[model samples]
Target: MAEYSLRAASEARELIVKLHNSCLTHINEVTSSLKEEFEHTLHLESDLGQWLDVLKGRVESPQLNSAHRDFGLSLYAAASGLYRQAFSSSRSSLEVFIATTYLSASEFKRRQWVSGKLDISWSYITSAENGIYSQAFIGEFCPAAQSDRDEFVSLAKATYRRCSEYIHGNVATSQLLPTSIAYDKEIMREWISLSRTTLLVTLHCFMIRYFTELDFGQQRKVEATLEDNLAHLVSVRRILDLPVERSDS
Candidate 1:
């Protein structure tokens, strides 16, 4: 009996050691090979900081704070090769972010949410009829995103569902995600691409809700990112009033 227990303990220690080594190896691979993709997402974090820093007082909602922190956590998880955790966190951030804007119009609703009285409605937030991305809802706050309503809404819904796949461990994802910690270029590529998409979607939603409220100086804080990431769209150029560099006319 004693010998068996000792052998079991040794095997357990070996498994633990193997797991840590796998994690370390995967981290090295991600940081080295995916440097460009990872840094691109980091840039979004910088843009987010500037946007929040300028209006920290007004945007002090707990949900937004949680969402921002989750975005960072998602990046960390991705680097650590925890793919499921990374996707889950990113999806959560998406939910809270859009929910923040959904709750913005009503202080009472916001307060109720803060006090645990109101629940965020994902269906309503993404409702094709009147949700945040709907023509009517967006036209009220952000005309720039209005023209591209279907595009943003579709991207948002698709990404949300994709992340849920990892979370729910659906049949396809079950086969995709390895049973143990390991580096997978394909999955890593998928995640990096998803991260950028999530960042862009969130940025659009954020700008839709609050960008115009910023003074020109404050807007300039995030202008570079918007231009770099969003300038291809004529609607964005129109909203920012950039020069007619393109022959959209």
Candidate 2:
């Protein structure tokens, strides 16, 4: 397996931390702004206001328990070592984001069913289940994603499989057996870049769909800020020869 110097590992970890912080900041800002806007403009007793309340609950619930945030923190903690743990966390983050995006795109009936309200015996929605839910979400709601559906699914599956190898004690786990506890800078950079990009893209789509009433100017400003923060990760994606899409999809 490839190895990296301690300095290289430290630098990569720092960059990952920066990206993680920026992403969380953006999420908080957007959610706060949206909540304030809704509270000020919509009457609580009105039908639309009630609907907004439900939407807000749903959006905020997942944001609070975000696997993306959890995984990002795990990556930062394992920056100097624990390669297997980092990969497992990354896989978990991806699966959670996929499920969130799918729920946002699905119809109300489906969402209720997934929540187990419609059928007490039914299992709650969890994993993306081999990209089926994600594929459906992209097809129904994300126009830009539809064009690159095959590539998106392929990349997501490949990333999940690679992470799963480490998690499931497969042959690839041998890569983590080095005596020196350090991660390859190039590998860590790629993993963080991909994870951050996937998360931002999914969050962008969810926000756009949920905050449909957000004014154009405010929406543009929020998106511009997110893009600015993501600039370095985007560059890393290019350097690593990964797929790149400027849009949320």
Candidate 3:
């Protein structure tokens, strides 16, 4: 077993707390700006206007249904040394964000899926064989993600594996339960870094897709706001040494 250091653990908890606050602040700022824009430019009758409504609904769903709220609670859990729960919650949030991104790309598909007329499953959405990995989906829906497809898939798969161990009560996770409540510094660091990067990238992709459907004037306004907030998110990715290129607009 790896030795645990109290001092190191405390520092890691502090770092996680700081990162959590920074991420939440940026997310709120972006969401608020988008909401303000939507209210100012209402157009419920048009196709693009209806699409924005759907985007607004999905972005707000995370908070309304507690998915985003759980992320914040997970950070508190990590700060209290509940690393297992924290990791699990992070993965859950990523899953929701991914689904939301997929849905945001198409109003007809999302409506069908939500109304229970579509026969798709979560596995199908994330599947390597016929899901987001297929070129058709990437090209037609989320071309921006194609820029760093390899990195995105690698990170998602690796983190999903690690989180599954904790969620399923696997032997690897059980072994850690008997140890000190405090998590290893490196493990906590990795979880926070991975979770933040996944969230920011997902949000950026969603925003980019939404922007593409807007007229030039509205697009410029939204893009300006996004680029301003994106600079800070990119800095966080750089500090974690994850993938700064993934943040490119």
Higher-scoring candidate on TM-score, 1 or 3: 1
Tens digits of per-residue lDDT, candidate 3, 174-238, equal: 67652545435555555566555555445454553454555666554444434433544542334
Which regions of candidate 2 are displaced past 4 Å? 1-60, 63-65, 107-136, 200-214, 225-249
Best by TM-score: 1
**Candidate 1: stretches off by over 4 Å:** 1-18, 244-249
Clashes of 3: 0
CA lDDT of each prediction against the hidden true structure: 0.82, 0.48, 0.54
Pairs in clash, predicted candidate 3: none
Q: Tell me, by lDDT, which candidate is best.
A: 1
Q: Using Cα atoms with residue i matched to residue i, what is each candidate's TM-score against the true structure?
A: 0.88, 0.51, 0.55
Q: Rank the candidates by lDDT, best first.
A: 1, 3, 2
Greater lDDT among 1 and 3 belongs to 1
Q: What is the lDDT of residue 196 in candidate 3?
A: 55
